[model samples]
Target: MSSLVQIKDVTKTFHRGSEDVPVLSGLNLTVAKGEFLALMGPSGSGKSTLLNLIGGLDRPTKGSVSIGDDRVDQLSERALAAWRARHVGFVFQFYNLMPVLTALRNVELPLLLTHLNKAQRREHAETALKVVGLSHRLKHYPRTLSGGEQQRVGIARAIVTDPTILLCDEPTGDLDRKSGDEILTLLQTLNQEQGKTIIMVTHDPHASARATRTVHLDKGQLSTAQPE
Candidate 1:
């Protein structure tokens, strides 16, 4: 498969009260189309930072981040926001669903930025919810749902726009083992059957096992060996 996401000699730094904190140092990575990649590391190893760089939520201090034909590291904030809405879907550890909105409305939130009208948005949201096996919960609010169901709603919201890439940050962290496995299976189906490329950051070995490939991060660099 051809490369869909590429990171070349990327470095990221943050400033804290006259002090510079280096997160990633000359890191390089390539994710192929339809690939399911798991990023594993200890806390503060820059896994989430790397994901942010790829998703255009944050820019690298040096080097490049390329997704498809776009140079993500170079895009302006406005352009990046538009690009993200068009190509990237994000799944967070927390469901991040609004407590007041029904599952369908929460899923429709992202489409509000597009040209799609209310009916079109509803159609897209319904389809996405069905994809995540939540068609029956469309009218349910987040507070009324179980942990796993809420996460499914979150997944529905993420994929409503049919994003080119899914950037998941510990998607299963908040779920029970059974629920996590279910979510992982759903992700696998999306990757294998629908060909959605996914880059997930996970700490659980079980979660990493669900991915097609796993890479480790330490300090600020990448490695193949599992951390001890």
Candidate 2:
């Protein structure tokens, strides 16, 4: 397993008024190609912050973030946006779907940034939906779908572009136990069968158990040992 994502000596700080809030300090991580990794911690533990750094949603205040051969932390804003559009896929806890769009159209949102024609985009979105067992819900709007269905749509949207990495933040946080398990199974299938590299931030141990490896964050630092 070759290294696909690397974070070296990274630190993140937020300035609020006159106070400096340090989130992550001297954090280092390496994610292998096609690895399913879970990040777990209590609130304010910087788990999501680390995921953001890896996904190019945010840059570290210090150190380098590298995915494959690209140094993400060094890229300009425009370049980083382009890079993220091409390589990173994000699935949020809230399932950020446009209310007016159907499931198919929502999944096609990411491809609009590419040169793919309408037909090509539709084909890709359809395939992604099929992968997540949502082919029948393509015409349904977010409001009409169940929590699990909405999350399946979100996953479809994330993988529609065949992104190099998938970043999920509490992907099943809003669902019932059964629904969450279903979503976790979908993620495992994507990892084991489709070979998608996933980095997920989860507070639930059940969610983390589905991952191939788990890392915990506390006070801006990572620990391999799970908390009791």
Candidate 3:
């Protein structure tokens, strides 16, 4: 498969007071289309930072971040926002669903940024929820759901936009073993059956095992990719 995401000699730094704190330095990596890749490392290893760059959430201090044909690091702020809405979906460790919104409504949030009508958004949201096996909980609130169920809702919301890639940050970190396994299974199904390219940051070996390939990061540099 062709390379879908490329990071070339990328570096990220933050200015803390008068000090320049570097997070990533000369990092180079590539992810192919339809790949389910896992990034693992100890805390503060720049895994999440790399994910953010790939998703166009942040730019590198030096070098390039390319997703397909777009040079993400070079996009204007407004352009990057639009690009992300169309091409990237994010899942966080903590479910970011709205407390007051119904499950279906929360899944429809991404569509609101598009030109889809209310009915169209609702249809797409329902389809996404159904895919995640949460159709029965369409009217439920986030607070009413279990940790696993809420994460399912988060997965549904992430994919509702049909983005080109999924960027997951510790997606199952908050759930129990059974629930985490279920979520991992769902992700595997999505990768194998739906051909969705996934780049996930995980601390759990079990969670990383679900991916097709795994790579390690240490202090901003990546280790070689290993078959899962």
Clashing pairs in 3: none
Among all windows of 10 consecutive residues in model 2, the one with the lowest summed lDDT is 50-59
Candidate 3 contains a number of clashing pairs equal to 0
lDDT of each: 0.96, 0.96, 0.94
lDDT of 2 by residue, 1-228 (tens): 999999999999999999999999999999999999999999999999999889888999999999999999989999999999999989989999999999999999999999999999999999999999999999999999999999999999999999999999999999999999999999999999999999999999999999999999999999999898
User: Between the candidate structures 2 and 3, which one is better when assessed by lDDT?
Assistant: 2
lDDT of 3 by residue, 27-120 (tens): 9999999999999998999999999999999899999999999999999999999999999999999988899999999999999999999999
Tens digits of lDDT, candidate 1, 1-228: 999999999999999999999999999999999999999999999999999999999999999999999999889999999999999999999989999899999999999999999899999999999999999999999999999999899888888999999999999999999999999999999999999999999999999999999999999899999877
Ranking, TM-score, top scorer first: 2, 1, 3
lDDT accuracy of residue 136 in candidate 3? 99
Report the Cα lDDT for candidate 3.
0.94
